[model samples]
Target: PLLKIANDMVVDLPTPSNISAWWNFGSLLGLCLVAQILTGLFLAMHYTSDISTAFSSVLIFLHETGSNNPIGLNSNTDKISFHSYFSYKHLVGFAVLLTALTALALFSPNLLGDPDNFTPANPLVTPAHIKP
Candidate 1:
């Protein structure tokens, strides 16, 4: 079945006899992009961006195949769709991400944010909110 599909898609596809070098350019770029994506997937599956371990993870190939971090390969593949831009799976995955972002913003706005951003414009004069 797979061979038949491949044959129909590639082997038996229509092509002009006078196809120029530009025609091959597109195919070459497609193959290069596919190779790059596969390599990126392999890398994402192996390493993690944990705050504490990120520095050390550089030295050792930290295997994250077992971990369920959202930045992992599974989550990346979940959003891919060749047929349509807004597929059901893609929308659901986006909704999940949006809900998590909203929850974090409502409950703990600065939980994962930089502490410096919450500071007063000028530390010498106490913040206006603290005066009242």
Candidate 2:
């Protein structure tokens, strides 16, 4: 039964021609997916799924200084700021991730399927529904 399904897959059929090196985007995409999954897992370890703690946990993970306290006469005045760190890193990471995803989408339009799959979200409503 599985073999029949595999045999019937017209989309999975490969051409007799050799694929160009440019076609390696699929492999690169797989690598990116792996990286995202691993990073996501690491993030999940520190993340709080509950609405009350979710934002705070993300802030702490992204912003908390990983140890670099100033030691001097005015040491009390110096405090580690997670806001700066988190904002910068988050922005950079998001930009890179979006760029990579966009490039993949461009390279392989069939990757995500038809236009019906592309749906816009109502951010305000999504959070309300996700809240526990």
Highest TM-score, which number? 2
Residue range 8-119, candidate 2, lDDT tens digits = 3422545336643234225665345446556665676656456548778777865664344435333645665588889999999999999999998888867868776577
| lDDT leader | 1
Per-residue lDDT, model 2, residue 53, is 83
TM-score: model 1 vs. ground truth: 0.25
Query: What tens-digit string does per-residue lDDT give for candidate 1 at 9-128?
Result: 443445677753345335875355445556665676666545447776754555534454556656655665555755877989999999999999999987998989886687578766
Error of 2 at 132 (Å): 44
lDDT of 2 at 33: 44
- The lDDT of model 1 is 0.61
Error of 1 at 126 (Å): 13
Task: Score every model by TM-score.
Answer: 0.25, 0.26
Error of 2 at 56 (Å): 22
